[model samples]
Target: MRLRRTVLPSPDLLDIALAFGSFGLFTLPVLIRGSGHSPTAAIVVLGLAATVPLSVRRRAPVPVLATVSLVLVGAALADVGFTVFHSNAGPALGIAVLTVADRLPRAVSLRASVAAVGLVTVAEVTAMQVHPATGQNAIQLVLAVPAWLVGYAFHTRRQAERRLRSETQERAREAERRVRAEERVRVSADVHDIVSHTLSMIAVRSGVARMVLEQRPEEALAALSAIETASRGALDELRAVLQSLRDAPGDPLRTAGALAAGPAVERPTLAHLRSLVGNLRDDGYPITLALSEKAGAPPPVEESAYRVVQEALTNVVRHAGRVATSVEVAGDPEGLSISVLNAAPAGGSPGAGPGSGHGLTGMRDRVALYEGTVAAGPCPDGGYAVRVHFPARPVNRTAPADRAEGKRRG
Candidate 1:
């Protein structure tokens, strides 16, 4: 807490101000310097020591208070040669009370402060009456209440301000975290799509080149050239996206992959499952995809809905134990549905890839945010199943349904 308060702001100046105020705190003694009974050098020294604590008031309020309050009690009781604790224990009590309130918890800090004031008040009340039974003095008794109250108010305001500032910083940090996460999602999905698609194209080209290697050298070279171009383009786009998210000490907004060119979309939607499944089947997974709707014309409601399936399938292909897989996308008017089932990879981690574990949670957040429902769990048939249902109303919709339907039909 001391470092938090002292490091960011100008602590030296604050400390100096506090120390100067400490000197002023003993004004009563200076005023009574030569009046009748003299306050000796010892009392003056103790008064100065009390002021020394004010230097570190913000740095270590509790320790400062502990030392000052103890010294204050002694200075108050002992005659100290001739001077009587500068005839003012009121200021010390008040400052210590404020320090405790600032540094300690409400209950503990309050009890200590109340005890200080009560003791001072009782001492003053007794002092006022000669041979007093209560052992109090009048002057300090009258002063303690108002001082403690004012100190408490000041401490409360400062603490409140500190809390508000901390909250604002936390919110900003959370916003930064979300921005970074979104960037990762955009980039990861893009990379997954591009790499997977390119891999397919390259594999086909390579197979063709292998056949034509001896018969048609030029054709093989042409396919190789296309591969190079595609690879370079993918790399360029990936680099741009990464640069945008980097904090490189210069232009804060790295315009690597911005939406001006439209969102960095690479991931396949439900419509692309035919090709995706074909690739997997060719690769020996022997996968089949069955859809609830034969037409397969997914609405905006099934946009993120589609990504969830892609992710689940990707997981199955990479981690599911069995080679053969079944992907099903089906639903009624209420919502769309999707599920991917494959045997768990033998001893394969439940999630074998780079999902932040928050992916499912994030998918959950997306579903809830869009007023949709989704469920993912290990299926009873010894595999994993993920189902997503996006309501027909749509997460982002404004047009009248009748007009939209007429346009669609037209």
Candidate 2:
């Protein structure tokens, strides 16, 4: 069987310092006492082998521990002046065993610890037989247990810290994904509202212009002018929506700032309802509008109310045809209520054909944001009606300059 060679990392500065320091400490006593019976060179060489290998103990802990143990055993068997319990050998062996417990798997490190302890004990016993003075080495055997315990404790703490860090990063990623998804839904709703309203007006005006082209040139010209105006308005709104998308911040957490980065688009409010009604009137839509505007409604609430009315009117033009429509906007201290009702077509059912239903869905989504409610269905008189109510709330208006500065800081 082929055996895998374990890759070891190059020793760093700390490892180099540790190796040299251990070497000096281990050999200092020998230098002072002098080699008793063995040659001075052999004892120094044996001390070097036992301690210097500690430098790479973290990278190849098992091998380093085994090497230090075997060298200590050889010295004791050869009857050198020192035995396995020499000042240098005991410390070097403890450091190697500590590293094995810290860096290797528990099962492998446990086996390594047992083998090291056995090897050193047998060597010390053999050396004591040759020279009785070496029997004190047996006391150092107990040091291995505490070294392994300390290293294992460090390993457990490090693993726990790594797991906590991983979970925190995953949660941050999930939150970003959710924010981006909400932004997409909001953008899509804006696009649908703009396109649906504009196209409905343009389709009606173009047909009128085509029908009266030669017989009544003035009426045709007026219809064409209305179409041009609606198209331009649609283009401006679409450009603003596109700019918002382009300017969105890369980080989902900063979505509000990203939206604010786009060029400020003037959103429709209750004041625009008069102009909206006038445009439909010009297109020969038999419509009557009544407005009772109050000032304290928030900007978001105003915009949502405008969208609900716009979508309702567009549905009237598309599905109800040229029918009498009444739009009423009433406001009190409590809240605002809007109602748009269109009578049934001259000879057909109201909303008879297949419909996408996106308009109503978008309306519900917008109203839900402000804790409002929307009701729409066919009435008893074969007419269609949409009614919406938004509860009154205090407006918190921040200056444009402050918003812009916030965006810059974000």
Candidate 3:
């Protein structure tokens, strides 16, 4: 029982209807007044020629205007009851002028408008000479001015909208590029941390095993076992990082055709510090750890804190070589704080290992993401120390639930 709404016709169909309607209105009155005597077939044909071309006014505005104008002029000269200012000819020419203004360049449209006004004036004057009643046609000449102005306004608005859409698309593309660049930097830093720490441990343990192999078989075997564990852990962490890159939400094809292997491995946090410290201790580093129970933090803050400690310890083993090290982690209402200090080596100066100089920079960058501060320097007692603090903030635990609700609504 429901009724469907009617859809309107397209522009081309509307133009055809206008052409036929105008021709019928123009010829109807003459036939009525003739009372049994209709106009010649030639006059009806001329009227059809003048109005039918208007159907293509938008496609070829200049040509359609010219054709309509010429037909009106011929009809006026032959005194066949058609003039430039008649209802049919006048409106048809006005439509053509509007179309020309909207579709052509301003300079070309302007010239065409001038030529149209001149031609219509000449045709009207010619008709007036033959029929004095046609003198009132001069008043209808002003209609073209408003039509041209309206069309020009439409053209200007269309250009502005096009430019706005172009600028919007450019800005969106720029933002996407920026996000991709930042992700690259973050992933690079993580890989550096993982590879550097694992390789450093393996190099040290492999050297120990090589030196003690003939003299002490058990100790050498232990060192080799440590190397195997470190390598496996490094591989797992690297796989996790690659999986994250593949599963990133921005562009599905960003890591296209790359294999995403292995189960998801949780990112390291304060809870994983004991295992990290134990691994370093087995490698013969003299280290002490002090940790205080703290309230939960956002995932990003926890990850960054763990990296800060790991990088500090790695630097200790690489630069200070088996030195006495102490790590402290504390949290309060204000923020979380971490400090790592290592005493001066037995030798006057610590021996340098393969260092890329990017560890400390990466540490600082991670802390800065959470608006934290980092300070690293040599103490007065000839010990190196790194200190970091991250401010506390409430975590939005309901974010996942909110996202789920939004998806359901959609």
Candidate 4:
């Protein structure tokens, strides 16, 4: 059998107990010595007046002090002043003063303290017919000031702690907002990259199938089949990304909600380049890919590399006019580098495509997060090129476990 520890009463309760006990001790002695333990109505009333006000000292400190001080004065006028304050009423007043100093602003508490002290002093001096200096008066006056000072110290410390807590909460909220914003931007970019690339290929292939429908039925059938494949692939990737957002809106972990409720959907990586390039080749684009012999890379670098190549090829299909294109990927531990170079535009026209400018912006934005760089321009040999170099792992920012999670929440 285990015994439970005794719970102590709070300080406020103890304060009330002490206040009433002192009143009884002072009154009991006088009643025993002078009245055979039977007090007159005046003595009883005086004792009640000093003690009762203390019960509410904390909540109504100023009012309690005023009531107790006035009653003490009334007792003196009635010629029972000597015994009235002997009830330890002074301590109750002291406690009230401390509470006032602790709870109110410094300017307000100072004024209130002065008023309470002045009233108590006037009453004591009036009852005793004594000078301001000496005896119990000096002791009472000195003690009250220190109690106020202690209370002031407690008040200052409490204020500082409150401010610190508020600032910490604000900073946490700001960080959460920043994370959410990044997540929204990343999700938007994924939608753009996926839909734009897949749809562009489908559109181009469908047009080829339409042009060859009568004269080359077999070739047209193959183009239509490729369109079906691209459309289905786009739908699968989009559904997985959207499902994650619907699953857990407040998950803080990088992959908290993404793929939690979805069927296993593999994210695109460097290995997927073969399939991507093959599909474009089927669409009649002259494209070549040269990947480094290096086996693996950080997920962020791999994913970014795949998207860059995909977007570059899509641009060629729309604008390059049958120009030869080549993709080169190579890296060491330091960084992974990629470049897509297309032969000069035919007939003095750049590859014009139905595309939102956000593609290049999104590519640059994603690379910058890993402290990587991207440059796209016309080469000295009159060819167009898109080059990107990503750090092997994120620098200046913590690396996330699943880089594909960025497709949903960043």
> Once superposed on the true structure, which residue ranges of model 1 sit more than 4 Å away at CA?
1-33, 37-90, 131-137, 161-173, 203-410
lDDT of 2: 0.76
User: What's the lDDT for candidate 3?
Assistant: 0.74
lDDT of 1 by residue, 1-410 (tens): 45555556477577667666766555434546642333556556766677767777767766766666566555445533122333354465566666677666678777776676666555444444533332334454455456556667776888899999999999999976765565455456545645554554566567667888899999888777766865775566555445444443333353332434445434235676676576555444567788665324234334455556555656665455235677887767666666666765556543345445555665565455446787787767556667776665554431122223335457
Query: What digit string (tens of lDDT, one per residue) describes model 2 on residues 304-382?
Result: 7888888899899888888999999998887989999999888783343546999899888767656778999999998
| Higher-lDDT candidate of 3 and 4 | 3
Where is model 4 more than 4 Å wrong at Cα? Answer: 1-54, 71-90, 130-135, 247-264, 293-301, 353-356, 392-410
lDDT of 4 by residue, 25-95 (tens): 76656655664222467666777777777777777877876786677566544455324333234465566
Worst 10 residues of 3 by lDDT: 396-405
- Ten-residue region with minimum lDDT total, candidate 1: 397-406
State each model's C-alpha RMSD to the native.
11.9, 8.8, 5.4, 5.3
Q: Find the candidate with the highest TM-score and give its number.
A: 4
Q: What is the lDDT of residue 291 in candidate 3?
A: 80
Give candidate 2 misplaced runs (Cα > 4 Å).
1-11, 29-39, 75-91, 139-141, 247-278, 281-309, 321-352, 362-406
lDDT of 2 at 240: 63
